[model samples]
Target: MSRPARAHLLSLDEWWESGEDREVRVELQEGVRIVAPRPRPAHARVVLSLATQLSDQLPPGFEVLIEVDVVIDPNTPATVRVPDLIVRSTTSVEFPITADQLALAIEVMSPGSRRTDRVTKSSEYAEAGIPHYWIVDEDLSVTALKLTPGGYVATGFVGDIVTSTPWPMRISLER
Candidate 1:
């Protein structure tokens, strides 16, 4: 016997209402729901370290958040991403943040999240018009990117210290 055809995609409201209480991290991509496993120790550490460093350097009216849901599509609401860290101004008040209010989105790659972080999420954030995106690997190497008219372009990559634009901050991953 052959497998049956899949059902229709879930609307953003429908997906939000489903709300099955679980520990897994969930996101929506083009009306499809994606569930990610919990972060490992290395991922958590990087997130914490990056958030702390960025938070301290952010000027007034800008703040750093960790593991927050970012609504990438305003027209359709089909994609909701939970970036590992986000930097946005204080003007946003809603629970799920919209793309325009965000300055940067950062993702610390986990074993399971490498592909999505590097490819899928990067594309989505760029399409959403977020200015900056950073990816941190397990080894603490960082890739800083800026969204241009064409797409995301790598600005810098460093294993220890990273100083990039859009944010006047210097990050040191040295132990």
Candidate 2:
């Protein structure tokens, strides 16, 4: 169910342990609450398809998840990013996975989320040391970004990117 927007500073523990049914998609931005609308059909489809493909090709220890909360920053007034998809370790049966467990964080850009995905999340994921990040635009243009000491750098590839970054697989950003 949706709730009226209000100011709530959420901690990592309160955010995870509070099991209230959060129907509206809410993400914590440095302890502040931000709500996002649900994804469109096309966005949802791409996420599911990518998850299926990734799951099929992933090694035993890694699994792909869709629209899950990731603890981007663990400090108080924490930041939790709900990425479109993530390739994380299956070893931990945790409710909300930390950035260290994540191998890749994927964001399917929406009309309202283009800037956040490309700039905001890109920097956040890099700062959290997520290793890899991918940005999928509405036109199915995929920008594969790898984390660097300087920042996140685009691999200069589009559509489909083949990688052995912890796992070997070919991910196609096609319909």
The best candidate in terms of lDDT: 2
Candidate 1, residue 115: CA error in Å? 1.7
Q: Where does candidate 2 have its weakest 10-residue lDDT segment?
A: 16-25
How well is each residue in 20-103 modelled by candidate 1, as lDDT tens digits?
A: 535898888888878878787867888898889888888899999888778888445488888999999998876668888899
Poorly placed runs, candidate 1 (over 4 Å): 1-6, 20-22, 74-77
Tens digits of per-residue lDDT, candidate 2, 17-85, equal 765445667888898777888887988899998998898999888888888888899888999989999
Task: Kindly report which residue stretches of model 2 are placed more than 4 angstroms away from their true locations once superposed.
Answer: 1-8, 17-22
TM-score of each: 0.89, 0.87
Clashing residue pairs in candidate 2 are: none
- Could you list the CA RMSD of all candidates, in the order they appear? 2.2, 4.1
